[model samples]
Target: MTGAWWAAAPAMLVSAAILLVPGLIATAPLRLAWVARIALSSAVSIACIGIAGVAFSLFGVFFAAWQVVLVALVLGVVAWLIRGWVPDAPRERVRWWWLASAWVLSALLIAVVAFWGVASPEQFSQTYDNVFHLGAISHILAGGDASSLTLRTLIEPQRAWAPYPSAWHSLVALNVQLCGVSVPVAVNATWIAVCATVWLPGVAWLAQLIARPFESGRVALIALPLGTAFGAMPYALLSWGTLYPTFLATALVPAAIAIPVAVWPPRFRVRVGRAVLAGAAGLAAVLAAIVFAQPRVLATWAVMMAPFVLYFAWRAYRPAWRAGGRHRRRAVTALVAAVGALVVAAGVGFAYVVFRLGLFERPLDDRLGGPQAKASQSVAAGISQVLGQAWPAGSTGTISFPSIPLALFVIVGIVAVWRGRRLRWALVSYLALAILFVIAAGADDVLTKLLTALWYKDRYRLSSALPVFGVAFAALGILVSARWLGHRAVRRRTGAVAFAWGTALVSALTLVVSGGSSAIAVVFALPAASAADEVVSVRQIQFLQDVGRIVPADERLLGDPWDGSAMSLLFGDREPVFPHVNGQWDPHRLLLAQRLGEIETVPEVCQALDALRVRYVVYNPHEFGGGDPIGNQFFAIHDAVGAGLFEPLLTDGESTLYRIDQCGRLPAR
Candidate 1:
């Protein structure tokens, strides 16, 4: 199984190219700094994929890798044609080796952690959400339709298609088609690429932007290595929900927030006509890419950018009020009115997206009850977790200790940046995020619901967002402390040598303390155990592999999706009558799910079997989640076997493949 990882090389290369090359080409005319370009490429590429997928669906063309590449080329050509309209800004001078070393180190650290987490490339997460994500990729491969607007048809075939973010699935499917890797391998490859390439560099770029006037180079170097130390993000998210789309979107958040600052620098003196237009257009393209990746992240980006926006607005317009005159009062009034109008506009937009569009509208009285009904921490505990950089509660199934080194660094960082006029916004942004986390993790009142419902009021999702800013602060904190110590040393030579050693020691200590915790180790090790058969046992997988030889590819099988039978869609190239474990299934599917075992007695069961063209049943009674009521929907199939209605075609231990001979033959499609 480990040898199969070598096959993932093609998938990794293809995934990286699909994610980076198009954006690199399109943004060439902008002439951004090397780091900035690398940070924004994945966002631009995802945006292009979203646009291409929608256009293809509308034009009745199949979504394919070749067509996506063509779309990117066209956009690049357009960018080149308009190159002369945008003015060049002064570029930061930094040695290429410095940046390369930082990136390589970060990539290596992330790769080691990822490799340790999933011991085999073919293994997949066995969490509930993974079922939909994996099935969505298979659906795309089988049907060649990868549009976000129609991807939900995998589970909701009866309803009119509504948009669900498919950027993650679309990219993985393209890799499978172009690189010939299995779905699991493609998923693992894409995840590693997103982490090493997108998340690591993005946070470093953001650190550079935030730590302005404080030597950007050192901050970036420190941030690159420290970004992976936090277990709250990338790791907790990987284990908790295996929320793949959220993971991608959150990884891009740092870049999305940093691009505006990069494009329109504080001292930008370019002409206000064409240059501004070009910059705005480029920013729009990147923002579109983020929305396509995950719409909820737009809220995350807005929360982080609010402080910057207010600060910038004040800095831009305060001159008029300071030069007091007849216009001074009018200027002040205009500023107030403008601020009020913006507040109103934001309120209206949030309402429209939440209430009108019906997004993130999980009821407070859901099956698992609501956020209010769950076990929660005290407000003090939540704040302490944020300050200490501890893992969110319930993510690791055990109490997590705070990283003392990280907490101290964050404090020093907050104090260090508080005095800088522009750099202080990083602290403010983190404060806002921390408040939101506190509300979700500690309080469960109306305010919590109002502020956090966009994230489904889930603390793990909210906690996952903290490290986006926490990493930047901690990096700044470490560099600031190192410089302070270096300046105060007794001798110049001793100070220099001592500074380097001290910085390396502190970084290593922080990484060891944060990344090597028992809790985080468990999180990384969970995937390997999940793959060991928490859902589908090793015997069940072998049973499916053997049954694949006898089952016709064109025919479908009926079974409880929770019992791991739906996996045949990938392993056996045979679609299940129910593609997922949960959905508002169509009448025929629902009828079969409930009464397929009674095919010998119920006329509707036979009718459903005939209509759905299901001639086989794959029964594995070891249902996931230990036979929860959810799987009971398909319990009637157990009775069907007991009644001798199914003719056994094959058997492997407890798993069996049976032909539905009891149901009369129907005309072939």
Candidate 2:
């Protein structure tokens, strides 16, 4: 594992370059403040990756490392050519040391937590969603295509092409190709890099924007350390669904929202025409990145920006209402028409997403009613969970304690910002998300589905987004409290040294009560041995790697995906008949899954295996989630060896590899 950690160094460097360099170069023409440029770089880089991937795929070119570099250079050159066209926004001249110190501290804290959580570079979350994410990266490498438009072909071959967010997959695949690391190593290292480089700085930038009228630099410093204090975000998402795409997109939300805030009327002081153009361009790039990374995040972005939109709309209405005489009726009518047009557009967009795009249509599962039942029992508990940043929804038992320190800070922050007109928007945005989370967590009805349909009404998804705004509020609270304490100390004739000690003591107490470090460890801990819930164990992976060496590349293996065999694509570099836990599998694959053991008894079984080119089988009976019901379809395959239809090729105590001799091998490619 130590070697694995050392191996991740180059992978992390490659990830940082892939995630940052292009954006930094391309956005140079915008002439933003250095902090603003750095904060938005990841979004720009992701946009470049996704666009380039689709372009390469369209042209039948390989999407490899050199291609990625070439795309970055091309974007940089285009941006440099337009340098004179886009007007420069005002740059705040904070001391370089202030940003440097804050970034270094934030990066260190985040890296420590991320590294400790991952435990090893090769380690990956064994959760359900990882099946698709890990396989998607491998699919990109295998097919030489990383386009979001065609990524779903891995699971939905019948469609041949479907729109699926693949920006995260593209970045990881590029890292693996450039660094020569395995998929798991690339995934873990890239996540760590994104958190430190993209997420922390992005949030700090948002805090600076929100507190711009006050000591903005000091607020950023206060916010940076607190970025890791929340449990719902980078940590919970990492463990729960292993939602790699959503995690990456959510990291950019703060920066994405900041673009509009910086450019909107009443707040922005720049010349309207040039500033609006620049802001709109930047916002478009970030939104493209968000859509590519995860389309679901667009809803989250819209929710967070709702208050700013209302504020802008209000500003537009004020002058119309105040106009004199004859112009008043015309101005008011124009304003009403504009507002109506916006509402109609929103309605159409919602319909397109729900019906035309066909996303977030999953119905609720009734089996897991305990959590929902408990949550619906008390709305107050749901509110407490959101404010405290306790995540994975319904984690209100003795094992999942609420963060009293965070809740108190958020309450204080709400009170502190209640009077400030601009900063109060943060409260409004936070409250909006908090309400959505409460609805998703505490209700499972028609209204809940209608409101949270974008997120499939999944409480975990809703809860994971709350911390995007919660952390800033908590940091603001701490900043105000510290300033007040220092003022009181000066008034009481206490020295600066006493104030410093008091702040240190209070910070330490807060950290302890928040349980930030301990909570991360608990959530990210991977199983050391094969468990019913865990997908694969250390020994199992070693065995798979060994089997990969002996197996021919041309032949595919048949196995129950729920038994962790789907991971063969990632760990063994060998294709599996089914690469995901669930999908709209074709009839032939379904027949093999249910009746592969009937090969001798049923002629169709042999024909199905032959048609699919599957000459080998992996029998790992330890199904994930303790014999998940999905694995029930493959019970016949599991009993094939005992039925004496499979020839033993290899074994590692519990898992075995068998050759299906009855199904004659297909001709070599």
Candidate 3:
């Protein structure tokens, strides 16, 4: 197989092993045709990664493509052994071409955005967070650890586990091992897969799950491509902060929603009672997926879906509690559904709380507080920013509001679904989530502090729910509006069906085309870091590589804890003296301000470096001394350079590497 195909082989395997078989078993009872089954399966499959990762950790094994094959085989056997998955009477048949067309269109749209922003040597996001993501991947590849639990030992305090979700990183590492792709290529592949394999298919599944007319699945499918167009999403995330983990986690949201929707719908009963059981399992899997990939995403989704979960519980049990003799089975079923869904939801939440999975023990940096911590945005300004009417230059990520037309559609859908059991869940949940977003952004210190207990006063992250639910609701709105137009015009106009379809198609297409065009233009239009910044970054990586040629891979480096310092750990395979990002491990920022700021004399500077075991000092005049002004305060080396206590090991114009072993100062030993 060609290398590209070789890289794709694992994706195909993952789809089959994790998605295809179980999806067949779970949805078979409903006799949901191909489109629904495939969409739901896509979600279940992503969740399976978390499960597989945990299993491997227990065995202390590295994740590879073949590991999925092993999991698939076991799941297949379990699937074979399970019974009672009786196929129901067939629903209205839909043509396969609609699904294929929608899939292709969604794939093309996702690809356009991904390829347009594709990072390369000359082209890359200039955001600050990219370093942590790129460096984490490199550390995994070089350090030879893929276990999500243990991998944090690379940069975190020794033996102290950091609960930063590593499922995304682990998957990238697996791709590298099995596909023999470079770390960058593997990173790109993970990004593409999250969008194409999970997000697109996931949206389709969610639409079909709740659509009133089953065939609205097709309309929902057609309408969902508009999802990529939202200003705060897929592209906005890339430009704003290069939030790789957030991107991965949010991409999995629709799939996460799909897991529960698959079961406990229509009404609750015992011959097929295991459906609720299956829902519980699927929910568990999705929770596992979220916890492993990005735990905060789980919290975010949980908060967003709080209302939906409550409504789900009420619907599942009310029928059973209210029904009589003839409705006894109905009552039993309803009770079962309610109990199962509620228990699972509560169980997941309980585990997260009890386990303290967020690693909150690590202190939050006082220097760089939460998004709104430094300076409060007035509630009015925050709302304006969230709606994309205006953006504060310093905000962490993109926040979007519905455009006028899109906003109109969303209101229509909300009203249309007011009485709909099938779709009503979306409305309540969205309102609940939106309220949280507003509260988080409120300027009142007391309110922000109260909400901080949820996500550290990070309002923008909560604002992500807008684009996610906004796209789906807007699509549904389009579907409802088209149907209304079709019904009203059937008697009043010629070719009413054709007219509704055409009007809907044109309107939906406009959103997709316009959104896609705007995203492409915006991303490509952003100035790449100045040619000077690029040269500085490229030379810094190259300089580190050259240093690696001479020093051991384990050499401890001391540099400013800014973007300038990324090269030492990312490219040079050396751990920096402090891996500081918003008070991650070290408290007080003492190491950053103290060790790097005041060193002057030979013995004094050497003693400080010895305490931290920092052997080399990197002075990138542009990145540290000159590039990012913050680097100077964090690691001020002007006095050391002036005093000649540091010996210049290498110099490239403005960048220099200094050996600390000068003035007869020997190694600590």
Candidate 4:
């Protein structure tokens, strides 16, 4: 653990350097102070590293340790030059006890969520996506290159344009290089770095933005604990997609939504510095970073950003055009310019996505998605799905749930904010996002297509962003109630004292309602199996480790990718004959799986090996996804061994490592 943390240090430092200037530049525009500045900086830092990796790749940098370090140094110099542009630092320090308390609670919850159910062997999320994710890491490590363009060409030859973001891979790869820890340990620690640097800070900044209307730090303070309390998200995604990148992107959603809205505020105001330009540029870069990370997450962000856009448009135009304000003429002119700028930015981003990213090369395809998993759940049904654990069964099992508590906060928040004229935009924004979540619950039809631009259709991923608005309203609800209940006591005690007590009471209630404790317990109940765990037992892993010692790292191993092939590639530090790339391009891998099962003779198996250009075959009976056809393939390997076709270099109870190079001659036939 200590070694892993030490390894993660350089990655963290590099990431922070990448974010510092942008974070400072975004401060005044974002009103990022105290903890929020740190949060935005951390999230932006992650984006900076991602941008650096792809940028370096585009320049044909091999993404070796030295090249990446040089890139980081370049970014550091740029940040230093820009550091002079930011001048809104507080003249005198104000101790924000509320921000401090929020930090303590948010850190506590993030730590619990980061490590709670996580353990060794399967140090990372052991969900389905683990196969591709782990393979991608090992795939990059195998060739010792992290070039985004050519990273996976070794395992996946078809596209050579595998556009998956290098944020997660790049960070892990850097850790592996600098830290000297195994990939799995580095992978899990990378999760912690993402939490501390991005999600925790992003949410803190977002909570401040949502609570800005009240001019109350209490809202920001209470929001985080309540937000982190919701278990299904951030934690649930671990089991769901093994969604590492999605988690990082979702963490930045609040900042993405908030910064744009903040740029176009409710009323006409003049900024008297380079901040106007620097902040806009910084925010644009931040948005681009996420589009690089996971383009699909931008959909939820747009939905959440819409009401704010509407608010900005209304405040900028209606009064000014009607000649209602003191500076009506100037305001109207500014409004037109602001709107025009937005149009230009939108056009550029659209061009980049449609022409540059190639995101929808096959949009309706299963990989990119069509109207497949349409939103079917209404609000209630969706809540049920979040809480419905397949554990303990019946009476006691359903005891762990999120709907009741979250719904309580939802209702309370709605009622509290329903009448605030100043918060109408905030209230409307929250309601709009909630409605989007509901609509996305079941239908990925026309509405979903229009909103998400057919980029992604799965509602599960969108739900991860739910806490942004949910926590906003939840904290507001608690704040409003606390203030109202404390109004009378203001006379007897100082208003601050009453407010503090009220905040404490509501915070406790939120903790219980968010089901933070239950969420932790639920993670344990949810089953997780790594590629190694899924396809091989302990004895099998033990034998493979021994075989890894004998099989030179230069030799590529031949085995079915869907089985424990990644474990060999990952643990053995050797490439596999097959790694899971998209199937349309690699149907031959399945054909190979089928052929291995169909072949009988030692020479025939050798012929198959010749195609892959390999001499080693690792076989396990309990290959993932067992059924008749696959069973037959397992039988073929067994029979080939029985025929004395290949020499078994190593054997466990039901698994064998065969050295195909030493196979005996086939009988005359």
Candidate 5:
């Protein structure tokens, strides 16, 4: 019950925060849209400044402050260019039905991601780095003293010496403390839930924005559902923290695309405030940085939208030069200010890079790194085969899923384009981008040479483009179905019947190909699945959750970083005992699990685990076979220590936990 309550706190607090921000803006004395936009943009700007400053202060990363300033400046330039683009229009009333549908659909997807999906092996195993760090963090949250925890923990040592950023972990800890819950669970749940809430709103909100230019509820409804579905995947939302800024960075992609399209400029009378487009870009840059701390997301964003950026710049420049009066001067000032801001931001970011990376070097040296030849390689190949063969299999069934309304909408979108609707060009452009990404991502060489330089190496780099494709497909479906029903030659009921019957037929075909009734049932059952409240309570699960909390914040606790990070938010400013990234660290423990019986050398295995100061052995039974000797040896070791080598902490049938004794050992480093 306590665990459940702790989990609920953050959700409730976020809900409250969401209401407060808009309410305060709405009720302001000179309430106007630009006021809200500027305020949010400014707050985001300041936050970035604070984050970079924190990094600099703690790690002596001198150029961190400049990165924040650089991003804000660039956004200012973009806004100045687009300042007058918004045309005067009446205050549009919010469409409740559209909003309701979007929220409902997104909520359903969250449930599926949270409950139905299998846990990830790559991310959720023991003997991975970050495990002990999270365990130590949990201990601190559970009432372990932080001063001792930090001094005694491996994560803290990593924080001081290694280049890992503490922003995400620290932020989660702060939220958990404020919510007054078990820091570990609340922090974990908060990351997962917040990722869904923040990004999904932007995704669905994009539909409304895109349809604004068209002024069609049908278009908005069709597009928003597709966006919601794109983010609903189990892997996307729940895989936070473990994946770090990548998930957060990916979430920002849609928002980067949407702000220019959706956010209406303030009425022309208010010339002092930032333009909506500028504010949007600024916010996107800052948010993108918060996750990955990578400058590339912003650069890609600017590059991708260069045409739009250029158009706005032209609008601002052309009018000012033509007016040749006070207006011309005002335009000149805005242009100068904008350019100045971008220059400043760029300078700051560059300086920070130089300070941390020894004169603007990449984290990893520029080498072929090596091919991904394991299961990851296999998965990449599978993804390639799906694209090459399945794409040409016919657009008819490639995106088909057994949902009636969705099927009809997709069909309509396709037909609407085929009939030479004016919107077809935009749809075509969107599809072109998705197809390009899918194709470019397939070749390991191409992926390594291009995107992996900016981002990490992953075939799933194509995932970002999926949402764009999803919305396009959904739009095509809706347009085609609507046209068929509205044809003048058909009787009204007959036309409606034709649309419904055709939709059903297509849906059935999709179900047949998608593994028959079970897959179909799962798809349809998504919305009906029960949504978990703010907190979920499991009996023994809370042990790991609490143990992570109670360990002194500075105490070094070793465990699998992969699974350890799931609830790591509770740990106060700690690092994972094992470092997972770049594979530069040792992996003897993992090898122990892999080659348990045939290893013939028990002493080496025990010595490695001990040397790592692995105080807690968290064994995920799901990943290890029952007959594995490492599992057997672990039990034997625990028994030898009166099972005192580890205190039996938590157990689900799927996972087991044991707390390791210090054994009179001193902290590493």
Candidate 6:
């Protein structure tokens, strides 16, 4: 098969895998049930497609197409295998309206990706997460095995120094293998869009779980617009270009928590089934863990859900034990869920250990760098930080359509506090926790707050503030609209439905206008660094290619210690020491703190390279003597290493490389 056809093969495999399991086709007697399943299936397809696209980008488009096919096959197999185990209740008949809505939302997301990809593909390059991770994968896929220290050194320190999850890298690598290696943006965008869609059903399911036995069609209905608004934040879209994949990972956390809690009551009765359910819950937790390494996300979800889990267990067993029925059974089920979840977590931890996962291997980063820490000192302050960053910039600090929604939620929250609705009370408690997170997140001395968050074992990572804030506002809007629908004059069925439709319409319009405005601002803010430079010398490029070739595939070559960004992206073997963003945002501090600020004499430069065990140095003459070209602190060291201290390695038309050979002077005093 052609490379493109081969690239698309993985999608077919994943799709078939999901579709052909023994019970997959059997479970869908009713059209509505099938529709929901299909929607989910489609989501899986989209995610695989996106991931494949990104993986292939590093290789080629043909490989990307194939990776999508593989992902589809994998998802299909999983869906098919698990088909029989899913809850089998025929609820509302599948409505055309639902399908149409799903289609529209999917279309919008696709359009957004296309617009960005075609209009500004460079935005996706050299991001915080992608560069280090993708570059590392590129190194591996290029025939340099993972066993090399080059891979280890580049990946390990980041795991120690930075704060990002490992799923994106792992996923990218998988796609590269399946899709071939070109460049992975197409697949990455597909993954982002797919991930964005997962939240819709996930939120619906969560609403159902929260409502319990009482059908929550209304809750689910409201979730569509509100969930989309919250999920499709500017950061998530803009971040697609960057390596930060938090939004993608966070998309599934609520459902993971909800699923376990939702089934607790029914599963408490059956021994085998309950065990399976517990395991499923645990699996969900594991998935959430994989997606989010931050403690705030974990802590918030746990805090919100833990009480409910405890209450359910207590209520379920208290009566049974008092009435002479078996209490051990329920206790055992809860234990199974907890233990299963723990087992899953252990497996994830092991994968992390084996893979040298994340920016840092030690757990302290997650534990120490979160908001939970700040909350402990002063709940009020933590809550403020959590609330501030939870919403988009313009959405907060002032009253507007989006901001008004938040204000209304606050008002309803007050009413709920006075009137005493149990669920509403729970929401209030969540808000209180959210406020604490806000405070911690926004504080100036955030490091202290991060430590506090970490101390809770990173339980506060969920930062309950985000979901709580969004849900609270959406719930308030629903309550208001429901009340309007209840008026006698509006008692007509047509009027009520019309009102619901109107609410959705207004919400969509508001989100579109607000999101559009933000997108425009971002487009205009691009810096010169983003543009392609015409002054790049062919000789300089050749020098880098040559150095890359000389560096042992097994041994990483550190760049000119000072200019890690351009060199790391363009030439270095191992993942760079610091993340691309850190290098970009604080290159001066990083260099100065790391002592790259003092390499004046040839001996100093040579000694520094030797100390770091660097094999090759790709020098940029223009960057070295120029006025802090990127306005980074790179110039601080330029004056230290005056022209005479170095010898030329390569001189192209526009640029020259200088080799540090230890001028006769002794090392610095």
lDDT of 5 by residue, 71-107 (tens): 4455455444654643333232436564455444544
Q: Residue-pair clashes per candidate, as listed? A: 0, 0, 5, 8, 49, 86
Q: In candidate 1, which residue ranges exceed 4 Å CA deviation?
A: 1-10, 81-92, 115-117, 263-266, 273-275, 321-373, 393-395, 488-533, 627-631
TM-score for each candidate, following the candidate numbering:
0.88, 0.88, 0.76, 0.76, 0.55, 0.61
lDDT of 3: 0.54
lDDT of each: 0.71, 0.71, 0.54, 0.54, 0.40, 0.41
* Candidate 4 vs 5: which has more TM-score: 4
lDDT of 6 at 116: 34
For model 3, how does the per-residue alpha-carbon lDDT over 96-184 read when each residue is reduced to its tens digit? 66556656566555545444433341233434565566656666666545556765654565455654566677666666666665565
Q: Per-residue CA lDDT of candidate 1, range 448-505, in tens?
A: 6666767767777777777787777777676666667666523432342233334434
Q: How high is the lDDT of residue 291 in model 6?
A: 35
lDDT of 2: 0.71
Poorest 10 consecutive residues of model 5 by lDDT?
526-535
What lDDT is obtained when candidate 1 is compared to the true structure? 0.71
Candidate 5 CA-lDDT value: 0.40
What TM-score quantifies how close candidate 3 is to the native fold?
A: 0.76
Evaluate model 2: give its TM-score.
0.88
